[model samples]
Target: MIVVVDSNFLQNPMLETYFNESATNKVVIIDYAAMEAFKGDTLTSVVKSTAILRRFPRQVLIAHGTKTVGRLTGTREEIAKAMINDEGTAEFREFSAHLDRYERGVRPDGVERQLLDTGRWATDHLNAAQAENANLLDVFKELTDGIFTKEEISKIRRGEQEEGWVAKGFGLVRDLASDLLSRHPDGSVKLDPKDYYNNFIFRMSLCVFVQLMDWIRVGSPSALKPARLLNDRVDAMFATYGTYFDDVLSLDKQMLRTFWETDAILRFVYAREHEK
Candidate 1:
């Protein structure tokens, strides 16, 4: 089994016990997991030495998030194989080394600045989520041209919509098509939200983010502060890559929920495509 465990599971000591050194199952150490460790207690709490060293001959595959799509591509992962063969992976390995130095009081000035910047972005994301929560019913109308009724929006907020509903209910692909003729188009051709199954990483990331907004809208207890949501966004990265693999092992209910939701979306898209 190719298991993708988010940063949460990476820190859990039990992970080392269950999977062991020579287990057949492969545990994926996504690119974000390493970078995410920099935020909290450095490498000590986020990922333990045993998690990597004890794995012995069993290779810990590092999965990189989609790169060419840039921000729309979501998070990146890099495996050991890539670290050795791919030049891009080498850059991330340097990040790992710098993180190690930071832990030892040799702060990597460049990476440290990047961590500070994430805080600013998280605050912006928080503000946006709050605004969207307030206008979930109306804001979508702007893009969708009022085709999505208030009642339907409410149903979706509650996750009540049935399978294959989005694809059929609205000319989703057409509607989302960018009005490239104008700079301020309803959408951009940079990425297509339709047929999400085909763009597994982007789709999974989108699902996770939308779910966060829904939680904020409904006042779900699981909905946490901006920093936590930022962490969940990291989980989204892992979840996105997880969809392309076998399974995900995460402690956070929100992360697991995001994973399940992404899987359902993938299945629905596949079913819809088959009908044609």
Candidate 2:
């Protein structure tokens, strides 16, 4: 089966062995952060980095947009120059730059804290909306009659069955998130009611947002550690793409559980400590 391995699996000797033994399989390794650090202004350094990405053919699943590069290189000479520039800039990609830390078994501090904070605000805002608008559920239920039961609506209100409910309604959720979380070029997030096919990063961001909301729905204060949450959320962002793969191997238990609970029928293997 085509298996996707997250960066964490690379650190575990046993898991690495598992991966090595399955070399013939269609294995993919992805680090979204690495790709993300490039979706900005294409400076000299950015061009240099994009060139390095082309070298790793099998490992990287995505590449920088050509249109994006063209924007930075208005002249054909500049474009051609960037195409030939082969100075290694792997260190510029955020995830690749963090390889040393990963090898040392160190975690990034305070990463994705803003996302968690934003999610907390979103939850509070959603709860407030439901409270202030008493007929909200009934109105939605009437509009989506026969699609969602009244009991299901009640469970959703209590955040008791959102995971199962949302999984069952992924197309609906995708449409909603697409409308609600589209990013504007001015570095702002806005709704794109008519556009859902473009903007890969925003789509992935919505997926992560939905997954994090699920965590908040059932999470206790003690269970939501910031560092761990950041790690898991980033891992979840990476794992979202794994939904398309045949199977996914992960050393992170939370990631394995996250994929298993999603609508995506992704086979997940939880890597365990192997005997010496």
Candidate 3:
């Protein structure tokens, strides 16, 4: 039997001992990501390390993070947008123009960079997860299922009926951006209107991506209307990448498990060494 423990519970050494003394079992501890979320902490690190060592015998556990899988999935979409321009469209050119401007001695504000970095991080994790598992799609599905609900996506669509939801959603993104900016070593810088606009576009794309992932993970027939609308918009943007998209969509659970294991271990090691 395999026992999985949440990072919160795993922090207690006694709890780990209790499991260790039990019958012959294999342990898989998850969620080394929690350490990053909380920053470096000794207790979390120890728990993470202990769990990893027991990987050969009993399963140890940790919490992934506060951000739901659906949220991360949405972030993945946003990163993909930055990495892959719309197949052959005017927006593609527009996006290129923005990048050109940034490359030509145009420094983006802290918020913009933070948002971009966040998207990149999410993408890295997603790709890592996929590479680790043969069946990446199923794992993606499971992780996403835990974060988004059909009702939430429906609310987003209904929000389209009113302007407030868009404002609220944008507000949420902006607030998150602002928070990230505040933490940067350097203070925020003034941004050109065009650069700001580009950031907004990327931000919105990320929000939509996150919402759609939530829909895909938890959506039902009731969510079909909004899901269809969102899917149409995304599909219209990248018609030729259908096969690649489908391949990603079909990932399996094993990939997800491996993603968690590897991520957890790396995070655990990082936390342990850095905590002191």
Query: What's the lDDT for all of these models?
Result: 0.52, 0.43, 0.36
Alpha-carbon runs more than 4 Å astray in model 3: 1-154, 157-160, 184-190, 200-276
Which run of 10 residues does model 2 get worst, by summed lDDT? 266-275
What root-mean-square deviation over C-alphas does model 2 reach?
A: 14.4
lDDT of 3 by residue, 1-276 (tens): 333333344345655465567655423222332222222343233334334333323222221221221122223235223332223233323434444454455646763454355445644654454354444235334434534345655665554333454344444444544553444344443444334322323233333334443344454423344334433333322211211121111122332333233334334544765586
Q: Which of the numbered candidates is closest to the native, going by highest TM-score?
A: 1
lDDT of 1 by residue, 157-203 (tens): 77775434454343443333223212223333354434333443345
The per-residue C-alpha lDDT of model 3 at residue 171 equals 49
Better of 1 and 2 by lDDT: 1
Residue 201, model 1: Cα distance from true site in angstroms: 5.3
lDDT of 3 at 51: 46
* Top candidate (lDDT): 1
